[model samples]
Target: MGVQFGSFDSICETAALVICSLVGTAQGIEPSCYSRNVEVGGTIIFQPSTSFVHIVAIIMTAIMIFHIRSKYTAVGRKEIVMFFYMYIVIELLAMFLDSNIIPTANSSYPWFAAIYTGLVAAAYCCLLINGFVGFQFAEDGTPLSLWFMRIACLVVFGVSFFISIATFKGFAGFSYSKPIGLWIIYILWPIICAAVYVVSQLVLVFRTLEDRWPLGDIIFGAAFYTVGNVLLFAFSVTICDAIKHYIDGLFFFTLCMLLSVMMVYKYWDSITREDLEFSVGSKAAVWEVKDPLLSTGLDYSEEDTVSNYHGGGVAPSLVGGVSGQQLYQKGGMGGRGYPPSDRY
Candidate 1:
């Protein structure tokens, strides 16, 4: 399924941003004033490349939540959302503590630093779990309910949480500056790996046209996110850290813009899950339509057989819940819209 686990909703992102803003203000989390040297009276306001990853984190989370609740609307979706929500909390809270927003050197809890690392690890685990969930969705907008998938998600979350706590408390915490655990989390077995996996799965589906999955806004967003993070990671590995602090906000801001825009103008994603039942030729010769106001995924494949309900005055749009008369056949050549009446 395209949208996180199909559409990007922004409610949670908005709420989290407001809460973080208030907290940052109260705690005096001074955003770096990169514009002070360039702009008049810039010292009084925030910079263009803001150091507020939490703001965008929540917004992205909100879109995932909205997609789960509205389109998927399944028990599995609820479970995935719950984990995803936890992931958001961990990341936002870490940003609040780890940043110079508040000095951690003389903090009451000597172990707080480890806690921050744990949060990062756990959050990545949640992200990977959601990625796995995305693969389970059937064409009909429900997950496969596969036990192995469910078990894998649970096991990873559980193990990741414990390992994160352990790594933080152990000697790894002090040497975190050149940390192996952190390196593994970000490099060898990076969180972005999940995004890569998703894109790979999508590519496979497109080529075979055997799976009915929506290539909704989430795919594009994930692709964008993966690219940004990959570039950032590569640069961090090779380059100096002096400029990263000042410009890191740009990467986060760019991701937020891409995702937010896709959420608003979701043309391809507008088509309902019903559309996935219809056939889309193939990746090489794929033909997709655009109707911006009607943004949601119309998942399809070359081998699909679409069946629609054609009755009453309520005509179904090619992409459902839209206002138009495109005269699409309710059901294709070999399909029937309704069952025969049991008059006998």
Candidate 2:
């Protein structure tokens, strides 16, 4: 949740920065006043306070790569692979755009903004795919709520893609700024994704509790992610434009670090621990005894057996032997014959 929130806040901060810059530019005022200026080899660039966002993004990409490589199962491995490839492609695109490697009409440098926007759309698409696969493989296997979330992500990805394409095609036009559409992409999409993640976590928590499984790791991890994202959102909304970018970057970087650490710690024992076993219902009983004692003998009738035992006139002793003295003292057994030795 923290990561989601942080990412959201970071995106919001980026949006706000871009909007402020656009508004300042429109008003014939310098947007650099709200940004930090840096000189690289005599060339000037306005470095937004949110530059740290890129740094954090790099760290997150690394962590995701590690996660993908470390994961063991086929599902986990596939998830990691998808995430890794998608993130790497997106990151590379972003770098190319940021570095201005592509040439533009006004400057000999490349139009990195168009490339960056396209990469963002691609990244979101990958995220959507990952979420879909994850929901499918979940223990419940496609619950209604999960299906809804998956569809919502897909719709968001589609919208983002169209917007990116428009921005890329109209790169030279004044109205081609993708930042305007990004307002929706960065602000709304993160919130939706975070909500889905939280709901999924809740489901897992309840399921684990029902099964009497340890939930400490899942609970803690989810709580961290959730809280981080919430803080990022709140900070982005409240901070002044001058400082919002820096704050946003800080929040994102911190969240990524924390999540990476927690995930590593939580899964460290995965190799040594027993594989989790999930069953739909109750287990069958297993009897160990080879033979069980029964009161009835084979081919015997209860009534007949009782009558035979009584008709023999066998005097009941203290321990199932004949005892004439005791039988006589109690009452004659209807003058039944008994040997002298039976007196004892």
Provide the overall lDDT of each model, using Cα atoms, as 2-decimal numbers.
Answer: 0.42, 0.43
Mind sharing the TM-score for model 2? Answer: 0.46
Q: Residue-wise lDDT of candidate 1 within 1-344, one digit each (tens)?
A: 11121111111111112112212222322222121212335322222333355566667767866765554434244545555566566546544443434333344322444444444455445445444443445422234444444465556555444444444344534232223443354234544655554565465446644545445555665666566554333332222235643444334434543453344224223422422434343355556668864465555442244323322344455575532432333343233323323332
Worst 10 residues of 1 by lDDT: 3-12
Cα-based TM-score, every candidate:
0.45, 0.46
After the best TM-score superposition of candidate 2, give how far the Cα of residue 131 lies from its true spot, in angstroms. Answer: 4.3
Model 1 off-target regions past 4 Å?
1-53, 72-76, 106-116, 127-178, 207-219, 234-344
Q: What is the lDDT of residue 261 in candidate 2?
A: 34
